[model samples]
Target: MKTITLIRHAKSSWEYDVSDIDRPLSTRGENDANLLSKKFIEYSFAPDAIFSSPANRALTTCNIFIDNLNVSKKLLSVDEKLYDFGGHQVAKFINNLSDQYNKVMIFGHNHAFTAIANSCGSTYIDNVPTCGLVMIEFEVDYWADVKKGITKMTIFPRDLKD
Candidate 1:
């Protein structure tokens, strides 16, 4: 079995004059990221690898989660393709992952995240809010074996708060 945890980048700060890709996370975003990370730890769901988008907001969210979750594994890597905003592209990227990682975490943008969740037959709420985490489980032996409509779990940040 394989598990994929899709995390939407935290809220970005428009106070900066930089481009969208360079926008950093807001204070609220940082706090929420920390909270989400703690929730992941509380649930004992730690990924073996963390794939993150190169965007500043996404990177910041990944870092905050790493620190807050206290995950000792330093297997974080940046993927430029993840910067794209399409659910199909996201699924393609995930399907290409190596078999070494059974549990993977991805920090990226939305619309794509929501699309992927929907494609996997998970009923995600509108806009997977900033710092939101969606955990989807698949009963596949390899990443390439993943298919649509095979989701076993769908967990959101709001659900974690309960």
Candidate 2:
């Protein structure tokens, strides 16, 4: 089985004068990312590799979670395609992942994230909130075998608040 953890980039700081791609996460986003990382550990879900959007907000979110977990930084890769908001682009990126990575985490933007989750038969409301995570398990043997209607689980940040 292959596990795909889709994490929407945490809340970004709108006060920044920089472009959207360079906007950093807000203070709340930093805290939420850390909190969610701990929750993932409590649930015993750890990714073998991480694919993050090149955007600063997403990268910051990824760094927060990885730092909170004390995970090695060597396993993370910044992918440009993750910056795209189209689910098909994200799907193609996932399909091309090296076979060695069975369980992976992706830190990216919303719309596409939620769209991909829905495409996998998982019901999610609107956008995936900042710091929200949806864990989808596919029974397929390889990443390339992943497809729509294969989702086995979906967990949101709000659901973990309780």
Q: Say which candidate scores most in lDDT.
A: 2
TM-score of each: 0.90, 0.91
Candidate 1 RMSD to the correct structure: 2.0
Kindly list the per-residue Cα lDDT of model 1 for residues 49-145, writing each as its tens digit: 9999999999999998888877764779999889978877788999999998999999999888888777775564567778877777888889998
Q: Point out where model 2 deviates above 4 Å.
A: 149-155, 160-162
Q: Which pairs in model 1 have colliding backbones?
A: none
Q: Compared with the true structure, what per-residue lDDT tens digits does model 2 show for residues 1-162?
A: 888888899889998799989999889788778878877776666679998999999999999888877778998999999997877889899888888888899999878898888876556457678888888877877888888545555556676675
Deviation (Å) of 124 in candidate 1 = 4.1
Highest TM-score model number:
2
Report each candidate's C-alpha RMSD, comma-separated, in the order given: 2.0, 1.8
